[model samples]
Target: MLMAKLMNLVSKMPINPLIGAAGVSAVPMAARVANKVGLESNPHNFLLMHAMGPNVAGVIGSAVAAGVMIKYLG
Candidate 1:
């Protein structure tokens, strides 16, 4: 979350830092939580769509990491 906020400060995109929290293995849940938090801060700030990108990316990253671990350990 902090990294996201920091990047946001330097980046040109208007990305909600809360969406950073959505980059977790629990895909939908993380996105939903980000959306909920965003809504809490501003009712009009619906972050679900923004969060989903990172959420899905996280899942894919986790799968790739798991695959690498299995290849090395199995």
Candidate 2:
């Protein structure tokens, strides 16, 4: 996803690993919050698994990016 690309760019900066972790954690939390909000108004319309697709993709994207960074940089 675009966020993964943005994170790759951001990684070029001299940020602490903890800060990077916090930033990454926000993705899943935001996705869950969005899903919860969406379900509240129209529970019959959207399934949890459907809402989770983007979240899972983002997680995978971040993981792949991190792997690439570690492999190349270290």
Candidate 3:
């Protein structure tokens, strides 16, 4: 429980945008590589990409996890 609280607090700490920007910058190159590997040419490929986007599971999982953490924290 202490570990979870510590991690939850740590996750909320503002990270340098350079770190995030660097991560965002790699997605396109990764997609291009996926294209070369024949992973991005299909319509379903976009679905997978969107799954990685803000609309799908990634951010949602964080939001839900944070919500749970906050609820219990308070």
Candidate 4:
């Protein structure tokens, strides 16, 4: 939810700033989300690893999107 909003807000910015913001923001956010899920889930469920997969993917996807956006916008 918040990530979506952040993306939307950053989309209006210039290419370089968008790429930098999204790239830097993703790392700590992914870590925070993974830790939160780990603490909330059952000990045996191993949800942290599962959650991190998508989180990292999202980060990568956003980075790719930023790159694509730069190709056209820059």
- Please list all clashing residue pairs in model 1, or write none if there are none: none
Measured by TM-score, the strongest candidate is: 1
Judged by lDDT against the true structure, how good is candidate 1? 0.88
TM-scores for every candidate against the unseen true structure: 0.87, 0.48, 0.31, 0.45
Ten contiguous residues with the weakest lDDT in model 4: 14-23
Q: Where does candidate 2 stray beyond 4 Å? A: 1-28, 40-43
Highest lDDT among the candidates is held by which one? 1
Overall lDDT per candidate, in order of appearance: 0.88, 0.56, 0.43, 0.54
Sorted by TM-score, highest first, which candidate order results? 1, 2, 4, 3
lDDT of 4: 0.54
- Residue runs of model 3 more than 4 Å from their true location after superposition: 1-55
Candidate 4: regions farther than 4 A off: 1-25, 31-41
Error of 4 at 5 (Å): 22
The per-candidate count of clashes, in order, stands at 0, 0, 0, 0
- Tens digits of per-residue lDDT for model 3, 16-60: 221222223244553344334444345444332432342233345
Candidate 2 scores a C-alpha RMSD against the true structure in Å of 11.4
Could you give candidate 2's per-residue lDDT for residues 1-74 as a string of tens digits? 45555666778763222222233335666555655665676786443455456556667888999999999999
lDDT of 4 by residue, 1-74 (tens): 45556667768752221223323336657545555555566455344444545556677888899999999999
